[model samples]
Target: MNKENREVVRPDGTTIHYTVTGPADGPVMALVHGWGCDRRDFDAITGFLPRHLRVLAVDLAEHGDSRSTRDVWTMEEFARDVAAVLEAESVGSCVVIGHSLGGAVAVETGRLLPGVVTRIVALDALHYLSLFPAQDECAADALLHPFREDFAGAMRGMVEAGSPPGTDPALVDAYIEKMSAVRQPAGLSALEGLVSWDMDAALRETTQPIVVFAVRAIITQEAIDRYGDRVRIETIELGSHHFHVESPEATAALLAAEMSA
Candidate 1:
């Protein structure tokens, strides 16, 4: 299916970019990308999906082609942005799938949209690592200061640090293209908010069928265990921190399967 671009005007006056793919009459599956990435992050997964599923992939504000007006970004703002996109398309209900930072936003979307989003798939994000409990001030300072240096340097460092080992050069290049375009100040500020926000309570409160694809690295078994039945945790063993690019087809298939279920 051909994808169409849309410009959604948020209440805050920011213009958000969203793309719709697949047949119009099928079940709608909304995809949200993680921090510093755009809607195209799902390219590897979207193409192979069944024609009966409509895909809506969005570039969260200030991340992809979407414009940003705020001096600072928060998880609440990100969640509202997703809601605005759905409202723009007049979507009444959908299966929401989000990756990394997008997962947190998806949870908030379920909360904001109420009965509209019946299912959620959080790929490789259950808990925010930076928010993990620390012993002392030094540890907290270390985590917070990791990106406080030069902005460009921080971005490059992030690319190196988060990418999966032995990742394809083409995939790496594509990821860099999406992430490098993020404005330094805006990206850093957004990261700060992401690090601080905790979504455990929200996840626990969600009554919708939620599946959390827990990445091998960063997330622990204990965290997944705590989620239990409310959160169906799955592991993508092929990739590291960024598994979407490494196993896009598998991710898409799982998404399609879950949405169908």
Candidate 2:
């Protein structure tokens, strides 16, 4: 399968960068990267997907080569960016797969295009109570305090929280450094959007089946109990929260399997 880099200009003037692979008419699967990451994160995974599947790996606004002049950083707006790419490609239907913050975007995308999105897949996303289910002003302020004071430190904390025991120290360090480099204003604003996103409300509106591949090491039973009735929660003993990147082949197999399901 060949990967082709492409860009789509939304009506809002935001430009989204994405890569497409496999046959255009094949079953569609859109890949949305997590916050502080880009579409390239799915490059390897794309390679391992079934040849008959059309994969769209997207770079959300300001996250990768995508550019946007708009100010809003809500996950809904981010989903619009994904929607733009889909519209540009004339995608009739697809399974939206998101990692971390991208999972929120996936839900928003499902809500945004209810008929177009068949199912939603979350990779270590939505289960984190600290970020999901919009926080109160006080709790939101408390979370933002750390990022405002020390962005890099806050970023490191975010990565470390996702990494489990036995994970390579070098891998953790690399993720910290990469995530810490997310461009300013957008980075912080996006985090704010995530913190304030109403997961409950979104889940209430989104009717599509959502499957979450949560890391067994970090996922809490509280989260499972909270969302299991709503979404299918499968505890996967993958590397860590960013297991897709660490275990691309296995992750690809799982995604392929999900699409078939």
Candidate 3:
């Protein structure tokens, strides 16, 4: 695929890097990678997508090729980074898709650009921590403790938790290594932002339809029932947490189906 590497600067002086493919006049679709991941994660996914659909894969501040000098690392801030990208590209309307943490960012992106973003798609996102009720102070602290103390060890535990019975050991190891290598303060701060995000509130303010393609083995009935009225939850047997990365063709089919609908 022929892609143009691009950069956009937000109001906070954060420089977001992104890759664009397909015709500028083509219907738009934005891809946001998960936490500790970059735009390249969607490289295969984009190839499997509809050829005429213009795709923008972004590297959020301090992640991938993006850089930032800002202190606030909230999902809203991340959405603003994406908003800047869209603004720079002069995209009038687009569907925003995000994976894991990017899911939260996608929701906020819809909230931030309700007029510009038509819908939100979450890949293995918005079911667990993102949708779960906000953690109390003590609970939040406990969750942060492990990462603050031993980031690598905690990253391993998280990767394992997201995997199901038959996932490959080598795949899990690869995820652990990649995630553990995320930049220091930004990685931790982003986690903090997610832990503190209020999904319910965001949903209340967001009018765009949201759909989640969550791992069937991991997503709970409680999650489906709790937000079913507001968001669509579709379970899949596709690998593990990083299912989109593992199964791009099928993922692209699903996404294309959604967009066509």
Candidate 4:
């Protein structure tokens, strides 16, 4: 299908790339990809969608086809990019669906834009460890060390040891491929920015309705118990961290339902 494409210039002059599919009069739905992925990640996954909803997929600056600048990256900057896109497209009220790091960006976007965001759907992201604090977790920067000459080895180690069991082989291959494409310093800088932020305040300030679609096993039962009411925690049984990749059809269905509601 033909897709409409454009670039939105953010306040600071950074460029964010975006694409629109479906009908213009349809309900506006924004799809934001997670860390290390691009806007194209949303393609080839959706099964059935609401006929009246327009889908907008964004490539966050520095991650996809979007332009990267010299300024320091922050979730707030990411949110501004989202706002620019929404405004540029004349999207009055939108249903925002984000995955992983994009989930945090979705929250900030809703908080900053207020009534412009009707509902938010976060896929497989509860609280990113870097942005969200753990009660007893140490201040150790074990996950932030500089990449060594054996960086490839380090990534392999992380996948083998840190990833959940029975992860889809294709999913692993995709991650490795994209991650390899990124320079070491760029990856490290982005991860550092993510880990350094205090996003709890941001989440608390967001008043829009939120639906958090998290993998069943990644998030603890206690975490679910605390936020289950406002944040409806849905499970993707098969996928690991990349739940959207495993179940985009279901995710899209849930968002379509939210749009209808």
Query: Number of the top candidate by TM-score?
Result: 2
Q: Which stretches of model 4 miss by more than 4 angstroms?
A: 11-13, 128-131, 134-140, 146-154, 157-163, 183-186
For candidate 1, which ten residues in a row score worst on lDDT?
A: 127-136
Clash pairs, candidate 4, are: 26-52, 27-52, 27-53, 130-195
**Residue 87 C-alpha lDDT in model 1:** 83
Off by over 4 Å in 2: 11-13
Expressed as tens digits, the lDDT of each residue in 12-49 for candidate 4 is: 55788998888888789998987778888787544356
**Which pairs of residues have clashing backbones in candidate 2?**
none
lDDT winner: 2
lDDT of 2 by residue, 1-261 (tens): 778999998755688999999998899999999999999899889989999999999999999898887889999999999999899999999999999999999999999999999999999999999899999999999999999999999889989988899888888998898889998789999999999999999999999999999999999999999999999999998797889989999999999999999
Superposing all C-alpha atoms, what RMSD in Å does each candidate have to the true structure? 2.7, 0.8, 1.1, 2.8
Question: Between prediction 2 and prediction 3, which has the larger lDDT?
Answer: 2
Which of the predicted structures, 1 or 3, would earn the higher TM-score when compared with the native? 3
Q: Per-residue lDDT of 1-261 in model 3, one digit per residue for the tens?
A: 689999997766689999999998988999999999999999999999988899999999999999988899999999998998999999999999999999999999999998999999999888895324577788889988999999999999999999999999999999999999999799999998898899889999999999999999999888888888889999999899999988999999999987877
| Residue 95 lDDT (model 3) | 96
2 versus 4: better TM-score goes to: 2
Residue 199 error for model 3, in Å? 0.6
lDDT of 1 by residue, 187-244 (tens): 8777766666656667666778888887666566667566655678877675755687
lDDT of 1 at 153: 60
